[model samples]
Target: MADTAAPPTAPKSMAVPLTAFAVGGVVALLLGIFSKVHDPTLDGTTTLGYSNVLAMKTVVAVVIGVLAVGQVIGALWIYGKLPIKAPSWLGKAHRAGGTLVLLLSVFVGYHCLWSVGWETGVTDTGYHVPARTIVHEILGCIVFGAIVVKIVAVRSKRAPGWFLPLAGGLLFTLLIAAVLTSAAYYIGDNGWPSRA
Candidate 1:
């Protein structure tokens, strides 16, 4: 006999968290980036004004760097291009990597308070934040979003591997953007114009 009950569909889990994290990553990346134009030091610093962890750009940079590598590893693992050895450690690494990026994202996000102050026309200058922070915030928010999705997936019993590709792609994109945008900003002027 044909089954009378309707088939079950996957629950709408990890959607909200994922979206928030993704958007957050982009926002963070952009804000961090564009704000650099006006205040280059904020892009990196050794001062412990906000978080001691971020006192050293090397620390934050290294972690984000690792997170980027983890993303690539995860992506490769998911696609079966890379061998999956010890799923447990890989999961732990991915989580740790995500946590690191999340922290950095928060650290970078601190500058956005200033960027938004200008970009939204809060200052005498129609556009306050330089173009640098724009890309920084965007990348940071994207990382934030990817982390959200990773956490949700982990909590929902989804393999940690699944989030790797998303994280990797976004991180890679941010890296490329960071370099290109920074170059362009410097070449054009102090930094790209928020409006331009």
Candidate 2:
């Protein structure tokens, strides 16, 4: 009889990951589709602690954008992809930051879709509509879809190692783009919210 070593095992099936991703995508796509079907509230939805809806949304977006910087740093550290070693607390902070980002997105996204919906050059008040508005609207949908992917990737054991980082990067990019197109533009035009 010949002695032989066991063969290396293959990776497990990706059924769970695929299902999670599909579910996320469908949910986001549906939300985007429904949001577009609704009419814009024009003045936007106002809430407590802000001069107006625009001011609130802008501030929230800006906050998220700044937090995104920390998110990236934390992710890089946790993954050991950076030059420096990560502190023990770094991973906990990363999780907390990601959770906060998701929660904030829900609030901001609801306001945008419920109050204003999709805006165009002709519809929204203030300066004339620009190409950036269209880009922003398109990116809004993408951001939702990306959020789904990111969440699923983070929670699913079936997710590939690279998926989490990729989704994180995508979310960061989309958030920045969304902020630039709307909040930053608003600040440039009208300055920060004071009186609404």
Highest lDDT against the true fold, candidate: 2
Counting clashing residue pairs in each candidate, in order, gives 37, 1
Candidate 2 structure quality by residue, lDDT tens digits, 73-165: 888788888999999988788889988988987788888888867656675457566798778777777788888888877876656677777
**Candidate 2 TM-score versus the reference:** 0.81
Say what the RMSD of model 2 is.
4.7
Which stretches of candidate 2 lie above 4 Å from their native place?
1-21, 42-44, 124-128
- The count of residue-pair clashes in candidate 2 stands at 1
Error of 2 at 72 (Å): 0.6
